[model samples]
Target: MTTAERSGAVQDPDARRLADLGYTSEFHRDMSLWANFSLGFTYLSPVVGVYTLFAVSLALAGPPMIWSLVIVGVGQLLVALVFGEIVSQYPIAGGLYPWARRLWGRRWAWLTGWVYAIALLVTIASVVYGAGPYVSSLLGLTVSTNTTIVCALVLIVLVTVINLGGTRVLAIAALIGFGTEILGALVVGGWLLLAEREHDLGVLFDSFGAAREGSYFAAFLAAGLIGIFQYYGFEACGDVAEEVPDASRRIPKAMRMTIYVGGAAATFVCLALVLAVPDFGAVISGENADPVGGVLSTAFGDTGAKIVLAVVLVSFLSCALSLQAAASRLMYSYARDRMLPGSGLLARFSRSRGVPPYTLLVAAVVPAVVVGVSRFSEDAIVKIVSFAVLGIYLAFQLVVLAALRARVKGWRPAGPFTLGRWGFAVNVAALVYGVAAIVNMVWPRTPDAPWYDDYLVLLSGVVVVGVGVVLMAVTRPYRHSDAAADDAVRSTAAPER
Candidate 1:
């Protein structure tokens, strides 16, 4: 078949659907339902999330912090339902940006995409940077700040090259990563649970007196970071909607699957690690800063632990690759809509590969710069990455809020999948949960820390939105956008800003 044929532009219902929405199909619809689900699963990467945040969660709230995974999971499932309805109605590439535009307007879409795209880049840097220490250890090298950054740079470049190979390569990489990470999690976690468990299941309910000044409630809320980080990877499914056939129907399922499976895997892994930790007091008292590393070293011994870390490195690589792919599609979508600086160049796709090469370049370059700057102040980089998550959450809430606004204005979702009458309740619940999570994320939890450190997530969000406002006033990129061209999509009752 010709490239266009494979892209679903010839005798394909999916392509016809794209035409109905006023766009030519450019992505090859070769990704199966399994491939689509794998993309989100790999992006979610339970091993990566649980590993990265395990120390922080355990330290802040003791064993009880594991419940944050449950709290965040339930809340994010609501958000996923709202997203499912939106994507089912408008399975547009770039996910949130196009969803917001269709539900609200061009300017709303522009700002939403701006925040989300930048967050994706920063997340890429954060994921790969987290992988740096593991990479250094696996190579039997001393792990230093400079060495970690160098390892991260190498990872970014490698993933970028693989991403440029095209859609099939991306799908294969995701599948391999998904399989290895899941199997690795099960094996290692199972081993810990069966062989090296040092505490009973009841330990989950015990804070072990780790709470600050006997304030258990505050510490518990502060420990919700693990679940927050774990759930958003599901939206990566919808980010590449064009490449997945039957996206309106299948993508919603994939989003929910991403949450359900990712949440379970994360929780299971956490339960294993926490139960096997030789001492919770040690973790909370700052005596066991590397509890996770300690657990692996004990359970798997030296060589076996190295093998497990190698599997973890794969998860990290795939996670970065998935984030990069999501960012590329978002940028490409922006360019295709003529709502970005370099519309023509950014939108251009390689004919043989059916991928946006220039957009991929931007995805790689931004994250590399962020990783490079981390060498200056490693402390600031961590907070910046947290800000990245908050920015993404804000962008997500924009889409949810936009959907709610449309529902209030009498816009019903028309697609292969929807909530029907339950739409409003689910949408409201999702909004409520999302707002609460954001408050918990940005709330000042440290009295001794600098005010900027305490409020970086909130302040950084304001700065990003403020920058978007100024850019909108100057460039007005939305004026050039032809998306959401139908008046039916936007309610007449709501006046455009």
Candidate 2:
């Protein structure tokens, strides 16, 4: 028996648990429970999601659009439940990649990670670009194409620098972001309710003639897209699980808490902004379509609006930071297992910092390049964001599907968290919801546009995933090193038993 095991000290439970799952604990295991929760919470930043999409939702389906939040929230809660179960069993750093690998196989896991990593990188770019308008407005500057690209690039650099500081700095930043966003939501929503509610509660049921094709159902589905996009990012907790002590148990709770807290905050903020609109019709379809800015300005003048927006800008920055961190961790985890090209370099962790600096650089630079697409055409950026959303949902659904398969094959949960007898039902429901959400998101709304333009989201997602498939086919990674790592872990863990 090992000295530590015989002494009953178990020097590092996290390390031992990782070894059991065929991975090494190279990351700093310093994140507390709250820190883990904060990471997920900030990644699912309600302030950023709600603020960015408020106008779009309002324009699509009016106040009735808020109902999508409840619907998508419930659906996503199901997803979070399944993810909680999986992460509890395999609380590795790469999140879906490692989970899929253990549950399915190398090829499937590689595709899952590839799709998810690409989605995350694109998400960082989308989020940074989304913040451009708010930043420009706060700075009282015109939001030209050049200005938007410059602002997004600057935000990406800032986030990359913070991530390079290591896990502790990330935790600190996430906690600050959580505090600011929650406080902002409650304070702003409450003030809007008390000081600027122009419409009655019944306005929530009004569709505002958005269903021009005579089908309210169609418009509602379109509006539901906003909620679909908002509720993800909770998986960021699982992505960094290896960096947290007692992660199997704690990460599950943190994932669920992310959805609960983030969903409530997003719902409250969206409803507040909807009710606070001084002229709903004008804000929805007329000259002043910026409902968030309009409501804030109406409630507390231009100066106060800018202040609140500046707080939102901070939230945006933190959201981007958390995203880059999650993406880099996923990359590092994949490379560490020899599952990607340049695995040796990408997997190298800084001895002093406990971070994969090369992966961090890739995470930062890719998003910067993506943001450059904004310079070509604003519509291109929109399509890219749509692709990001679709890619993430597709990747998530893949994992859910794999879990269902595992369940059928009699795979049992190995950790403290489980759905018990309800696992099968919840997994099935999650799969159904995930598929429905993906179809809803990818369905083309603009029939009049050119064919290529109309199918932008679908095309973008396919192209990205196709490239990953091609790369996997050509390179066939994980044939040697990953197997060796698994053997090494098993041999190292054998003596502990």
Find the candidate with the highest lDDT and give its number. 1
lDDT of 2 by residue, 1-497 (tens): 46765344245777777666655576788788898998888888998888877777777788899999899999999999999988987888889888888777788889999999999999999899989888888888897777778889989999999999999999999999999989988999999988888888999988767766657787788778679778998999999997888998999999999999999999999888888887767755756767777678878898898989888999999999999999999998888888888899998989689789999999999999989966777465556667888999989998999888877766766577888878889999999999999889888888899888888888888898899989988888857454422121122211100
lDDT of 1 by residue, 310-429 (tens): 999999999998999999999998999999998999999986897999999999999999888888875644575687789889999998899888888777777777787888898999
Model 2: weakest 10-residue lDDT segment is 488-497
Q: How high is each candidate's TM-score? A: 0.96, 0.94
- Which regions in candidate 2 have their CA more than 4 angstroms from the true location? 1-10, 484-497
TM-score of 1: 0.96
What's the residue-level lDDT of 192 in candidate 1? 97
Clashing pairs counted in every model: 0, 0
True lDDT of residue 391, candidate 2:
91
* Candidate 1 structure lDDT: 0.86
